[model samples]
Target chain A: QQQVKQSPQSLIVQKGGISIINCAYENTAFDYFPWYQQFPGKGPALLIAIRPDVSEKKEGRFTISFNKSAKQFSLHIMDSQPGDSATYFCAARVYTGTASKLTFGTGTRLQVTL
Target chain B: SAVISQKPSRDICQRGTSLTIQCQVDSQVTMMFWYRQQPGQSLTLIATANQGSEATYESGFVIDKFPISRPNLTFSTLTVSNMSPEDSSIYLCSVASGTNSYEQYFGPGTRLTVT
Candidate 1:
């Protein structure tokens, strides 16, 4: 079962515009949500993350808006640049025990055009 | 953050041939993980390599098909046995670091193309 589901398999946005990717998770026990960015021929890197206690977290131009009640979260890139064009994945993990594993979404390929 | 280097970067193997991918980390870590990214799919965890014990594999993965070896804390190798067209994918290794949290750092993946 895919615990996390992401929408819009691909996206294209112009420079200086807002690029948003949404994700929904089914596991209520999941308390940690993280977004990863990947370029071709490279592995995914942790871009930003948030916990259940926060409604939103921002790191420079990258912002993660999380809704605890809805079990949904989103990543928004402000003033999107062409360099940000890549594949993005959202993941959820439950901190219940020592062997917690990550459940990942299908993925969203974003293209920020200049 | 931990820096990881994976060898070969990529390879194309013939049917019935096997390829071994190596992952080296700069610092010693307690755990190392292997993941596979199939075409048009997200990354899936294949197994977790422990320094002193047998590796723990996830569902749909077997030790015979994908053998793993962790000789020490900083290095590990994954071998894909009996290459098949369906085995083509990107293989990645990751290690968790700092404050003992779930934040993981990954190496540039090795692309495997089986013919």
Candidate 2:
């Protein structure tokens, strides 16, 4: 399996609105789901993350809703700002004996306008 | 989260030339990895850097093509040899730490444009 499918290759929203991005995985062994935010000419920064056991996690304006049985997770950005405009990626962690490997989603380009 | 830095933020290299990207972590990390992110594409892991040993490469990647060096826990390097135009891509270095080691942090990444 090892695939994390993401939807809405691009999104456009107004400032102060909510931006949502979804991702699904085929591998059940994925124990951790992480969301990353990347700006132009920059690395992907860890935005928020959730475990399979927890259904939801909130970090300030960023939240992650996870579905264990459905094998899906989503990132919700509340009060989306123009500064939040960037490419977002969803990743799943596969823990091998020696190290953990991460499988990334195709990525979503988000634009928040005033 | 660990602070990771990469050298040569962007480079334009000619065909048949090779380039080496360096990754440095602020603190000691348990694991380090090298990834390639093509234009408008997702990150594809090339190999894992094991301290004091040979790297474990993934399918579709070989040590000869992408040689890796992990002299210590806080540093690693990836060399793209005999490059072609298709080799143009952003190379990134990531590290995994913490007690459970579930989280991964990425570096700024070196953008390589082969012509």
Candidate 3:
């Protein structure tokens, strides 16, 4: 089963416009929600992360709005740029003992056109 | 955050052969994970490697197929044995970092294409 589900397999936005990607989870045990940005041929890097205690967290132009009760979260990129064109994955971390594992969403491929 | 590097960014191997991908972290870590990302699929955990312990593999993965080695806290290697065309995927190594192990950092990944 896909524990985390992401919407809009691909998206396109004009430069200076806002880009949004959404994800929903089924597991309530998830506490840490993080967004990762991956460029072709490279690894996914942490873009922004939010704990369940916070409803929202923002880093630079990237923002993560999380709703614990709804089991949903979304990523908003303000003034999206061409460089922002990449694959974005939303992940939830479930801790077991001393280790934590991430369950990733299917990912959204965003393209920002100038 | 830790700086992670993987050797042989990509390789194409023949069927039935094997390839060993190495992961190196800049600092010591208690947990390291190996993941496989197939085309159009989410990253799946292959195994978790801890220093001085046998790797813990997730379901559908066997230690005999994907043997992991964590000889020390800063280094680990994953060997994909008896490769097949279905084994063509991107293999990534990640380390648990940050306070409370709240963050995980990933290596660049090794793209393996089994022909």
Candidate 4:
């Protein structure tokens, strides 16, 4: 049913510029939102995450802006670099009593070019 | 963060073959999961491997096709049985930082190709 929807299947931004990816989710049971970065031939790594209680969270150059009422969130990379070129996925977590499961977005492939 | 590793980093199999992938964690964890990523696609959760019990699979996934075994807290195995070309994908294993934490970590991944 595509609980989480992401926009811009692909993106290109110049190095040192800002790169942004947007995501919207439908399930309110999703209490945690996390962004994962993946490189080719590798596993997805957790980049940053935020809770529904927080409007924003920043980890170094990576920032996550969340809107509780809208059920939307976005990831912004300040000073995007060629090293940051990778696929980004937005995921929502819902606790199922004993464990948590994540529903992922389609993904956004970002390319930071010089 | 827990360090996770998967065996048989990649494999190529013929149709009707079965491939088993192993996942090992450095520390004990209560919750472990299996995920699949098709070519150029996002990750999809296959099931949750519970220690000492049968795995809990998500919708669209079943035990007969993707059987999972969590014999202990730090290890699990996923077997893709009677494979087909459509089964080609990268299988990944992940674990929560801890039961009380919200963070989850992933292993490198097992790339499988069925011809």
Candidate 1 error regions (>4 Å): B98-100
TM-score of 1: 0.95
Fnat for each predicted structure, in order:
0.57, 0.71, 0.55, 0.60
The stretch of ten residues in a row with the least summed lDDT in candidate 1 chain B is B96-105
**TM-score values for chain B across all models:** 0.95, 0.96, 0.95, 0.96
Q: Which residue pairs collide in model 1, if any?
A: none
Query: What would the per-residue lDDT of candidate 3 be over residues B1-115, giving only the tens digit for each residue?
Result: 9999998899999999999999999999988999999866679999988888799899999999999999998999999999999999999999985324979999999999999
Per-residue lDDT for A3-113 in model 4, tens only? 899988999999999999999998889989999999999999999999999999999999999999998999999999999999999999988787888899999999999
Interface RMSD, model 4, angstroms? 1.2
Report fnat, model 2: 0.71
Please, what are the lDDT tens digits per residue for candidate 3 over residues A1-114? 539999889999999999999999998888899999999889999889999999999989999999889999999999999999999999999987757889999999999999
RMSD of 3: 1.3
Tens-place lDDT digits, model 1, residues A3-85:
89998899999999999999999888887899999988789999999988999999999999999999899999999999999
> Which of 1 and 2 is the better model by lDDT?
2
DockQ of 1: 0.61
Model 2: DockQ against the native?
0.71
Residue runs of model 2 more than 4 Å from their true location after superposition: B98-100
Candidate 3's error at B69, in angstroms? 0.4
lDDT of each: 0.90, 0.93, 0.92, 0.94
